[model samples]
Target: MGLRSFVTDILPTTLHTRGRHAPTLVGEPEVETFAQLVDKLGYLSREDLKQVRAAYKFADEAHLGQFRASGQPYITHPIAVAALVADWKLDAQAVMAALMHDSMEDCGVTKVELIERFGSPTAELVDGLTKLDKLQFSTREEGQAESFRKMLMAMSRDVRVILVKLADRLHNMRTMGAMAAHKRARIARETLDIYAPIAHRLGLNQLYRELQELAFSYVHPWRHAVLHKAITRARGYRRDIVERVRSDVDKAFGEARVKVEVSGREKTVFSIYRKMREKHAGFAQVTDIYGFRVVVQSWQECYLALGVLHQLYHPMPGRFKDYIAIPKPNGYQSLHTTLVNPLGTSVEFQIRTEEMHAIAETGIAAHWLYKVGTKSSANPAEVAQTLGAMWLKSLMDIQRETHDASEFLEHVKIDLVPDSVYVFTPQSKIMALPRGATPLDFAYAIHSRVGDHCVAARINGEPAALRAELKSGDVVEIITNPGSRPSPGWLNIVRTGRARSKIRHYLKNLEHEESQALGEQMLTQALRAEGMALPPESAPEGTSVWPTLLRWSGNRNPSELMLDIGLGRKVAAIVAKRLAQLMQEQGQRPDAVTLTLARYAAGGEEAGATPPSLVVVDGSEGTGVSLATCCRPIPGDEIQGYLGRGEGLVVHTGDCGVARRLSARDKELWIPVAWSEEPVRQFDTDVQVLLRNDKGTLARLAAAVASAEADIHHIDMGDEARGETAELRMRLSVRDRQHLADVLRTLKRSPSVLRASRVKPERPPG
Candidate 1:
């Protein structure tokens, strides 16, 4: 390995713009050179440096004559970015990517050109860093979010993408002062919101602090200036106390014969501002701002140093934390304590080993900075690798289930938040989840199947609702039922992106399948009316037939045409007539016997009722076909289907006035619908249960529903608790009409219930 890993004299800044007659990279007196960048790659072979230098030449040529806001050659910016990547001792491809990240976006250089120049991996990383300027978006924020999502997805596949992107961002931020005031504020806010949090999540403490301080300076310059003055004044007043404490600590450690390095740690202005806002306190109340970090040689010495410090000062109650025993999710390990010093002031201290200090400072970057020659007892690089790679792998899991860029970013942002709760599994295995995460999130984190089939949860072996928020140290056990499926409401309460994505994926697939089935049924009924038989789409003639039908209907594929028919976007009868013509042209003829049978099967036509196709709802149908909210139709209820445009077949209770209104306005869109005898899924229908005003009435009502084996999906009490009685309105999920009857019977049998009846849509609140 090169000696560059131990060198720390280099300065950090981003790429600079190019000038028309600027000095060459190596020839310039002040500009960063090829040698400077190559020197930081102590871990790489000479060939790697050669490839990195070649990339620099390419970027330098492409950015010729371009000048940044700082009036420097544009090539300098990428060179600085590459230099930072080299600081982490990233591979040659990563350095190449950093050098060319902006070439495609700002220099009109293409990804294809980059691939031919520096290979695919470098091109791919540069592509990830490229913004979405080519695509037109309705909003600027939306476009920005999409670009971030794209970058994160690429970063998930290769951790180096983020490493380079972060370096690029750091460089840009360092030179942000050259930009316009408004632009600077916007960039600073973004750095604070997105980049800073990411640095913290990656355990890049030095980068995190710099980004936060830079952002705070521009985001609230007035506040930052005021805090700076206050801190300077406080330092002057506290110098004597601080020095005395340092002296006492040094003397005590010397007596114990323990070799250690101690340094003064000061709180940043942003942290002070945040504390002021969160605690609603004045600056004077932030007593623990004065702190120190003690770096020892070994783990044993960390504990020994902690004991020495506690002996020197009275330790504050409940202010001790042993992170070395159980490291943070980011792989940060240290012993933290607060003590009352001789001056009656509280001072915080952090204790850790030198290796731990390296990991804490550089995070995953430490892997290359301090690579081992052989397998050691405990490797900080391996620890950071396990934790960082685990998080990166999870991004793939989330992306598999979430297709929308915005939604994917949303999930990732939720995961980036470090405020987490540690919950234990039934086996006592601990897992960290973002705070406010419910049992559904826990189930998904454990396994997607567990979340899909989760019916309930038990916290500390006591029955808990699935939506209950998990607390740290809670022993959570999710109960799974193979027959149970995720609920739409789960999306509202689940705190993790993984759970939300999985649920949405399952629902989307379910809806598509149901829509296809419904569309086929409608098209078949339409074909019968056209004096034709429905042909399989997979057949040779059928394949050609659909393309013809889709052409006439302005659809792209067979599934799209069916989905349109299912969603009432197109009249099935009209499409069927066109399809019949196409089939006839293909030399396929309609069968007389099948046509006659289908005509009879087409609902209520003989009795002069609307002769529309029928749709069967067995509760398993996804959102493709839904029971109308206005009607709340269920099994055993005579129903009619309304194919509203973009709304899959909507089943309405036959007597519904909304159905009548829709039929009057759109007669051709009406269809017949029925309920399956043994529907595998459950349907929610509302009911009003009148109960005598008494305690335990809700428990009794729940018991009755449970006894009938029906689940109460949701319930609402009246606006106010009335005098002698109260009405509990419940939306119950029942399997069939018989199941509904059983639930009503059970409710009526309860001693507390005065009356129980199905809630009609037209009924006014009483």
Candidate 2:
């Protein structure tokens, strides 16, 4: 029979029939019994059934001596989980995988063994369900994060991995009473916080509600009992009211020439407690505790039935929602409305077609089994392949940005929060983003590159700050620049994990490049000091010496060694010495003439005289070198480079007291250095400006600097500035000494200026 007829036309077997049905309480039937499992096996071929039985026997043997906390054979749990998968009419492989999911972890069942026996697909599924038991973690939370990361990555590759795992968890929760109270509470909390939400997100609403209720019973037994009794008592007291409302709804639909089936959906204790906590309301204030689900035969009838219910009672303003118009992320579609009954108590109603009801009940799982009657224009495969799988697709994107399993897992959790706001692109395309997302979030959602280069934003055609919080219906346009790069400050404001991870990734790459260049420069300077030259990459011996050098240095490649040098984890001079030793062993010696030229070239004024240890600063060194922030030395300033053990090279102004102190301590490490004729980028230098006190004087100082084409990176005001003269200490980015001099000259032209001079360093970064 076809799926629709099988699902909708066929009625589930009653308990007395002893036939296949939805899961029921234990003792009604053993899940492993031929009748219970074989009944659902009609969809599987004879060979498939045989394969499933073989897996069951293998697991049963592996867990032969094992028992659960309940003192039952461990084999029973896998059987029960398998039964749940069979109920969903999943493929024979899924059923087999469920049977073997725990064997790998509990019985030391190997993937190779499973693959040899049951094939790769089943083995893969089992592997996905297995946790990383062999690895040690710093904390239980860390271990859990890592385990979940593995499971989620597996789920992204194949959805059935999580499906079978959820079933396994459900069975465990069902029998959680057999475990210790503390263990039960912990597992239940995990189920409630992670697994249940995942089920709901997957559209398995049947499992979602049951998991919540089961976890609730274990998490707060007393509360569950109290709420259970309260609901029962309330049910008895309101029986007449409930019957009256149902009777009235039926009659209203009948009179309106509509057909509908109404069933009550009760709130779980946890849900009730959560709603109370979130709304800051008492139990009595919870209006939707006992809501009615109205299932109609067709989409048209669903709306017709909703109208009849609204006509019967006054709808509470703002309580109506048309989910059928825009279904949830999980593809759940329904029309929900809360109305006041004649007795003045609030009553909630949900209206949906039969197919919509099935989808709502099953969620993601509905895509596999819910081929109900033609109430839906789209098939389950189409729905599952598209809307329900959107989150699964996003997992790949998140993985692209984050590599650390724990970090990826954290981002996945953040993405799964369910609540989000819908926004639009400049082209009118719609995108759903987590609430509190910013323009950066929008840019990343559009594309990673867009987010990387984004410099500014425009919301609704008006210029908006990059950090501006995006609202629903806002049309966002991202402005990008080739030169503009992600700033470290963006990490604090960006909302989505994708944006945060990508920005971090870019900055990390940029830092590594800078560090590598610095490392190379430091090594060159170190080799020059040793009266030698860095061996040419194309030196004889028929090839580059870097591979040989890298092998001896225990480095994977040249960049890594350089990065180590740049990061201050390894000293450039030491590496250079070892490299020189290698080259000397290879019959190459330092060119004496070349060494003299390097020394004279590096020395200032007294070129050919007894030369000093000479180093050069070009403002273009990568990560391996840096100019001291304390001294803020620019080109044309008398400078000295300090070979700080493993800190590569740090250049400082020669006259700066901080540099003098450092030189005194590490006198051998200090070397004379000169600036390159032209630098690639702007260098930041401090200028102490003395100005007349005036309201616009500060603005004039800024204007003068801007007119000179200088950018003020930072500004500091002296305490004495509030008196007769203002002392503004500004760090300005300039091309060279000429550029800085021009900026100071411009500031002097203003009548408010008294004197301008470079500020010497007081202290240096540690």
Q: Pick the candidate with the highest TM-score.
A: 1
lDDT of 1 at 479: 92
lDDT of 1 at 322: 81
TM-score of each: 0.83, 0.77
lDDT of 2 at 311: 90
Q: Pick the candidate with the highest lDDT.
A: 1
For residues 1-766, what per-residue lDDT tens digits would candidate 2 score against the true structure? Answer: 1012111121122211111112222223547553577777787888998998898789889989998877887878888888888777778889999988888988888999999999998999999999988789888888888889889878877788888999999888766665667887899888887898888887788788778877777777766666656655666577677777877877787788776677776665667877888999877787666778888888888788878888999999988777776677787889999999998788888989877987887776666676554346665444454654668767777777676777776677667665677778988887878788999988888888898889999999999998888887799999999877777899887887677777877766777787677667667877775667766566673155678888887889777887777665676678888887777777777879867776575663565464444455787664346788877888888888776765667888877778878877867666567787777889998898888887788888888889999999889885552677777788899998888889888988988899998776785455
How many pairs collide in each candidate, listed in order? 11, 11
lDDT by residue (tens digit), candidate 1, 500-548 = 8888889877777777778888888788877887878898888888777
The C-alpha stretches of model 1 lying farther than 4 A from their native spots are 1-50, 135-142, 178-182, 280-282, 372-387, 550-557, 567-571, 589-591, 594-613, 618-620, 635-638, 644-647, 654-669, 676-766
Cand. 1 TM to true fold: 0.83
lDDT of 1 at 232: 66
Q: State model 1's lDDT.
A: 0.80
